[model samples]
Target chain A: MFPTPVEKRSRAAQITYQSLVPLALILWLLPLIAVALFSIRPGVDFANGNYWGVPSSFELFTNYGRVFFESDMPRYLWNSVLITVPTVIGAVALSCMTGFALGIYRFRGNLLIFFMFIAGNFVPFQILMVPVRDLTVDVGLYNTKMGLVLFHIAFQTGFCTLFMRNFIRALPYELIEAARVEGVKEWRIFWYIVLPLMKPAIAALSVLVFTFIWNDYFWAVVLTQGPDAQPVTAGITSFNSQFVAQYHLMSAGSIVAALPPVLMFFLMQRHFIAGLTLGAVK
Target chain B: MTLPTDPPTQTWLQRHRMIITPLMFLLPGVAFFAVYVISPILQSFYISTFEWTGLGSLSEQGEFIGMQNYRELMSDRNFEVSLWNNVKWLVLYLLAIPGGLFIALFLNQTVAGIRVYKSLFFFPFVISQVVVGLVFSWFYLPNVGLLNVVLGWFGSEVNILGNPDLATYGIIAAGLWPQTAYCMILYLTGLNAVDPEQIEAARLDGAKGVRMLWHVILPQLRPATFIAFVVTIIGALRSFDLISVMTNGGPFGSTRVLSFYMFEKALSEYGFRMGYGSAIAVILFLIMLIFISYFLWTMWRDERAARL
Candidate 1:
């Protein structure tokens, strides 16, 4: 609206605007588009210096099929699903109760506790690296999916609590008050009342957390070592090494590693953006 | 025991529910955060005070070498380079804000297929940074990639990632690809909620284009800008993924930020000096704390206003 909609402008301007949007989009995503193009080509194309030419033969399925059948790609993908799903459920579950308490109550240190989660949320992962890794090893959970999942759930709760608290704060307090007047038990009120109102937040946070945990490379590199537990984000490094300079297969592997989250973003664009913007300042 | 009409007595759980309920609800979340997040921060500080290889428990095997790691950091040349590169990253990464706003404004229209266009523009952000690094690494390939191809038309060629002087910038450019997309999405969402009435009022007063943007539009997009600032600052600091995937902090070790440097010291094949890594982490933490305090201050002010 601030730019003044194209419809309100001259016909030439409108036509220019329409063409410009796609042009800009093309330029913006050109790098990714190049990778997508590479994923479908034969490996020999690179051997002959055909880096940017039309593919001589399409090997889309063949290249992707090698990634699936001839490697540990599936195992890593499974590990990622195992790691991501539990973290989402655990973090969201914990935050719901935390958010409920922080949003509804006026207890001592409420703001302090709320700010602690927020501040923790912002702390660089480097600061926690040595200690967390040591802690994981000490518990003998190193190289295990459970250890990674535990750390992720704990770490993600910080942001999830912040998000969920803000959302729950926006819910009508009168609804809780009216329920209290009926002498409904407190936890029951949370279960039968507030949790139901939190469906959208849960959906948004779940998808956001899923994408985050899936794309997580640092912890996957640190806490887990082998393909047994490494997610695709980290495993793709070895995948690249195994097929070194085989750009066709490497591109396919990278695309496969990136696809789940891209799909999540596309499938849930509204909720994903809502989760991100957080509407913090205004 | 009294007559049937007598009121039921309040159980202790029911009577003290106000204090107890929130406490109960907060317990698990607070516990997890304290153990995994809060306690580790304090532990990092403690660990920074000792010399440990991280083979055994810190208290038993670690020697009390107070301030030694920090002293080493002061003299370490790699640390010096990393610190400077971090400064470069912090300054340049913010270009994404204006870059994103420009793209957002350009795309902020009701044209045909605009939704698909916007989503496609935001495509880079949804994927992992490793892939972004790979994409850009290939994009900057010496003679054959898109960047060199474009430059070839002008008869100039530079090996970007292979050059020590240019590698960090190349990686930062890779970083900006996604960071800009992130900021663009934020602004697009912010722009959607901008008050059209205020724009109509301004248009009557003859404020248009850049003048209108500076006066009316940007002020409304404050929240988006704040978020963009927060994420970009954090992203700039947490720039390990691209560095690891693309350069591995090489080209004469020119691209290491404190985060990557810390990891190299604490882990990797460099022999684990847990204390030294924690020391570097502590420094990064202190830098981050400055921004964290300012953000928390602003949010506190907002929360206070909302309370009344």
Candidate 2:
């Protein structure tokens, strides 16, 4: 509306706009497209300096097969799933109680507690790095999948709490008041009344957290080591170093590491966008 | 006699339950959050005052060397370089806002397959920064890379990432790719909710093109812009993954932003000087605290206003 819609423009202008759309999209995604092309290229293509030309042969199956079989990629993928799934569940579940409390109650320190979560969510990861690592090592959970999962759950709760609290605050408070008047137990009120209404928030938070934890590289590198616990993000970096000039294999591995989150985003695009843009419009 | 009106006892319990219920609900989240987030922040501040290598018994944890690490950071050349590079990153990263707005405006119109186009444009943000770094590294690889090949057509060739002078910029470029996509999505969403009636009113006043956007549309896009600003600032400050994957803060450490530098000092092959690393972390935290305080203040004011 602000820019004057293309539909209201002249016929020639509309045609020009339509033609330019694909051109701009291609230019924007050229790097990713190149990576996708590289992923299917045969290893010999790089050696022969055919980097920019059409692939000498399509080795998509061989390259991807080698990545899955010869490397620890599958293990890394499994680690990502192990780490991400629990993190989503733990963070979401914990935040639900916290969100319900802060959103409904008007007790002293409620605002302070809510602000703590919001502020904590924004602190740079480095500030927590040494101490968190030390804590993990002290607890003997260092270099383990559970260690990463636990840390992620705890940290992600900060953001999830902020999101969930704001969401729950926007819900109809009359229902909660009605339940209270009915003399329902506090926990039962939350369980029966509010939780059902929170389905959308829960869904949004789950998908967002899944993508976030799955794509996490920093904590993965900090708290874990090797295929024993490392998620695919860190594993892919190690894969890069090991493969050296094997761009084809590296490309395939990158694609594999990125697939889950990409799939999640596409499947939950609306919810994902909604989650991200929660505070943007208003 | 036993039923002597247990009213006071029941009232006392009920009164306490009001407080206890909320605390009970808060316990799990608050406990985990305090241990992982709050305690670690305080501990990091404490650790910054000590001298330790992070590789010894708990009793042997380094001696108290109060402010020594911070004093050293004052004169440390790498620290200065990192600080300067961070400034550069912050400045250049702002380009993403306008760049994204332009893209969003271009794609905002309703057209067939526009949804797919928007999704494809946003593809970079969904992937890990590691992949973005790798792709860009390959793109800028001296001769055989796609960028160099494209440049060669115009008879220009440059080793973009390998040169210290251009390495940070190169990495920032890579970072901007995804960041721009993120900003674009935010703007597109913001544009969707813009009031059509106001636009029509503005057009009636002959406010077209730049004047219309400046006086009418820009005012409405404040929330989107604010979010973009906050995210871009944070992203610039926390730039580590791309630098780690692509250059490793290299070309003689010219690209070492504070985040990566802290990681290097604390964890990488440089050997863990936990105290010094904590010192750097403390500095970064203080820098971020400035922005965080402003953001929180604004949000708090908004919350209060909404309540009123």
Candidate 3:
């Protein structure tokens, strides 16, 4: 609206605008396009110096199959699933109650507690790295899926609480007041009254958390080790080192590693964008 | 209401229910959050005063070498390089805001298949940074890369990532690809809510293009711009995944941002100097604290205003 819609402009101007859109998008996504091309490329193509050439043969199945069967990629993918699913559930579940409390009740230190969560969410990970790893190792949870899950759940609670609190605050208070007048217990009121209305928030947080934990490379490397516990993001880097010359295999693995989150984003596109743009607009 | 006199126990319970109920709900979340996030931050500060390999018991094996780690960080060349590199990152990462605004403005119009184009442009941000690094690494490969191939047409083939001086910039360029997309999406959302009446009013007043955008549009886009600035700064500072995937802070460690360098010092094969790593982490934490405080202050003011 600010720029004046192209439809209202002169015919020549509209033509110029239409032509630039695709060109701009193509350039923006060129890196990803190259990777997708490389993923489907035959191994022989890279050896023959056909990096930019049309693939001599489309080996999508073989490449993806090899990534699944011939490497530790399957294990890594399973690890990501194991870590991410529980984190989404745990973080969301915890934040629901915390958010309800902070949003609905006006207790002493309420704002202070809320700000604590917000502040903790933005602290650089390095501050928590050494001690978290130490604590994980000391608890004998290091190099384990549960360790990563616990850490992620706890860390993500900060952001999830911020989101859930704001959302709950925006919900109409009349329902809560009516429930209170009927002498319903607070917990039951939350369960029956607020929780049902929170389905959209829950969905949004679940998808966003799923993508975040799945794509987490730092904590995966720090809190876990090797195929036994490491998620695909970290595993792919190790894969890169092992198959240094096998760009096709590495590229295939990268695509596979990146698939779940991309799928989640596309599948839950609305919720994902809603969750991400939470504070972007007033 | 006093027809039946309540027992003291029941009356007391009823009186304190408000405070007790909220605390009960907050307990589990607060416990986990305190142990994992809050306590560790404090622990890091404590650990920064000691010397340890992080392999053994803290009290029995570690020495309380107060301020030694911080002093060493001052003289350490890698630390200096990482600090300077972080400054460079902070400066350059800001380019994403304007870049994204430009793209958002370009695509803000409704056209045939524009939704698909917008989503495709946003593809980079949804994927893992590891993939971004790998793709860019391949793109910067000296001879066979797309970049070199394009440059070769002009008779130039430069090894961008392999050169120490150019490696950081190359990686930053890769980072910007996704970062700019993120900012663009934020701005697009902001633009969607821009008041059409105000735009019409400005247009009728003979304001157009850059002048109109500068005077009318940017002020409305403040929230989006603020969020963009916050995330970009945080992303620039927490740049470990891409650096780890692309260079491992190599080409003679030219791209060692503080986060990666702390990991290298504390955990990686270089050595297990946990104390030194904590010191580095503390510095990064302090730098980030400044920004975090500003963000929280603004949010608090807004929250108070909303409540009132």
Chain B TM-score list for all models? 0.96, 0.95, 0.96
Top candidate, metric DockQ: 3
Q: Locate the minimum summed-lDDT window of 10 residues in model 1 chain B.
A: B1-10
**For model 3, how does the per-residue alpha-carbon lDDT over A167-197 read when each residue is reduced to its tens digit?**
9999999899888776778899889999999
Evaluated against the true structure, the overall lDDT of model 3 is: 0.91
Q: What is the lDDT for B165 in model 1? A: 97
TM-score of each: 0.98, 0.97, 0.97
> Which regions of candidate 3 are displaced past 4 Å?
B1-11
Give the worst 10-residue stretch by lDDT in candidate 2 chain A: A176-185
- Top lDDT model: 1
- TM-score, candidate 1, is 0.98
Higher-lDDT candidate of 1 and 2:
1
Candidate 2 all-Cα RMSD: 2.7
Q: Once all C-alphas are superposed, what RMSD does model 3 give against the true structure?
A: 1.8
Q: Is the docking of candidate 3 incorrect, acceptable, medium or high quality?
A: medium
RMSD of 1: 2.4
Assess each prediction's global lDDT (C-alpha) against the native.
Answer: 0.93, 0.91, 0.91
The window of 10 residues in a row where model 3 chain A has the poorest summed lDDT is A24-33
Per-residue lDDT of B245 in model 1: 94
Instruction: Categorize the docking of model 2.
Output: medium
Ranking according to lDDT, highest score first: 1, 3, 2
